[model samples]
Target: MANIDSTAAIHSHQSWIGIVQIITAATCWGTLGIFSTYLNQMGFSGWQVTILRIVTAAVIVLAMLPTLWPQLMKLSARQWFGLAMQSIVGVLGMSVCYFFAVSYVGAGPAVALLYTAPVFSLLFSKFLLSESITRKSIALAFMAVFGVGLTMLGEQAEVNWGILLGLASGMCYSLYGVLGKRAMHDAHPAPLVFFTSVVISACGLLLLPETYQTYTQLLTLPLSTWGYVLGLSLLGTVVPFGLYMKALEKLPASRASVFTIFEPLTAIALAMILLHQALSWIQYLGVTLILLAALLNAVVNGTTTRVPRWLKRRQTV
Candidate 1:
């Protein structure tokens, strides 16, 4: 029994390490937006930007195939299909919509709208997972929404179709996050990411138009653009998510979700640094409120509590 307890304690410590890894991953993922703007300024089409991101990231994943192939071969068809869907929703769908929305509108409002993910995640948990709806969740949702509105600061009356696109992207990403929790079960995180990258890359390469005439343009891209794109693909996509799954293995979905508030915060800070986009006092206050709400929600749904739906589903399975 003493030996058993010792092993359990060691496992617990490892799990904490995983939590830290995921937070680091989330922060890196947030910086992708800043890079996207640079890509846009260089006259790259949205599809071109998406293709490079997926293809480059996929190459990194495929490089690990010697170690990853055995796990891929062992997966059930259902699991493989689920992983494919994760790629579609989480990578392809999220990227296509987000880039277009950012282009159509602007990054500040685009990000504010996209931060609606947590509220939608809670809703999906209630509907799909059959988790209980709590007053605390509702309050957090309200606070988050309000923060978005406050950030807009009387600009709500100027809403347009681009705003709708941003909201749709947020909704899609929310579902992606909720579904990812289940689809990732019993899978190797690195391979899962690799497979997702491959699928998204293949789809983009096949579907999106590639102009060979301007293909040489890519080679001549300014050093800064090359640096940003590489940064986006490496730090933004590969390394961060590689760490996120490790952290998710240790942390609860709800708790892990809270750390994502940093995603927008990082983007905001980067914008200020790279673009010198100044935030109004009202916008800063709104950001603070949203961050506070996220913290409150995380505290209220501590890691110890079993997500009601996951608990019930585990029993049924």
Candidate 2:
């Protein structure tokens, strides 16, 4: 029947559309460095920026609660627990670490450092998802780590919180992927992310003392500050997240991962153009190595899904 066909079509996968959606999502994610760095320059501390971003995301999601309720209701106990852990370790942890990473190290290196996520994911997947590790996974992980080391090796006048925090963010991001995938059984990502953002905002508030005086300074903030926050939430976070989910619904995760290399590339380009952050030649080579390893790892992971014992990494902004 035409009616049945229409309903099926609504749920059908369109590969090309998914590809476009993913590319767009990754590009949007690339803006994270620019927004976060600008906010930091406006005198917000790393944790304050983290709190503000999640608070914005939470408020936006709250406005959509009616639509998300159905999905929220569908979450099981196990899923709920998974989401809670994800909120703490993934959302909250990554946000604070990444904001500080960008603030301290500049955008390009911070973005490059975030590439370490896949390496951490490969390790986490084994324990959390019960995934098997392969020799290829080990090799690719080592390559990624070597690249990661290169990203951090540069002139430092003092202790570099950026590198440590960036690596921590990557670990948290890895945790997010494994936990989110497990929590996501039949549940929409919108609702899962909504819940996670809410938890992040709550945790952020509990640390308000870190920014209580900072808020006094923010009462007179320029209107553009609000715009930056809005852009950070809508462009860098929400839109990309929604787009990536849509893409995943229609495309293979491997191809999606490949396209997402655009995220780091975009970040580096934007940083160089707008923020005037430039990496050394060695660091550029490091970024290239990490990206190539990730791409190959994605292919190997996808092709050997049911055969070889390898791990996979799924990233988000």
| Poorest stretch of ten by lDDT in candidate 1 | 207-216
**Residue ranges of candidate 2 with Cα displaced over 4 Å:** 1-13, 74-78, 156-159, 185-190, 193-216, 307-317
- Taking all chains together, each candidate's TM-score versus the true structure is 0.81, 0.86
Tens-digit lDDT string for candidate 2 (35-97): 999999898888888877776677676667676678777867876667777888888888889
What is the C-alpha local distance difference test score of candidate 2? 0.78
Model 1 TM: 0.81
lDDT of 1 at 241: 70
- For model 1, residues 1-317, the per-residue Cα lDDT tens digits are 99999999988897778767866787797787777878888887666676667766676677676776777778788777777776777677777777766666556556666777767878887886677767888988999888867766744313666567666777777777666666644444655655654555456565545633234567787777778777878888888876776676777666776777777777777777886766678777776776777678777877445556565666698
Q: Report the Cα lDDT for residue 241, model 2.
A: 82
Per TM-score, the best of the predicted structures is 2
Q: Which number leads on lDDT?
A: 2
TM-score of 2: 0.86
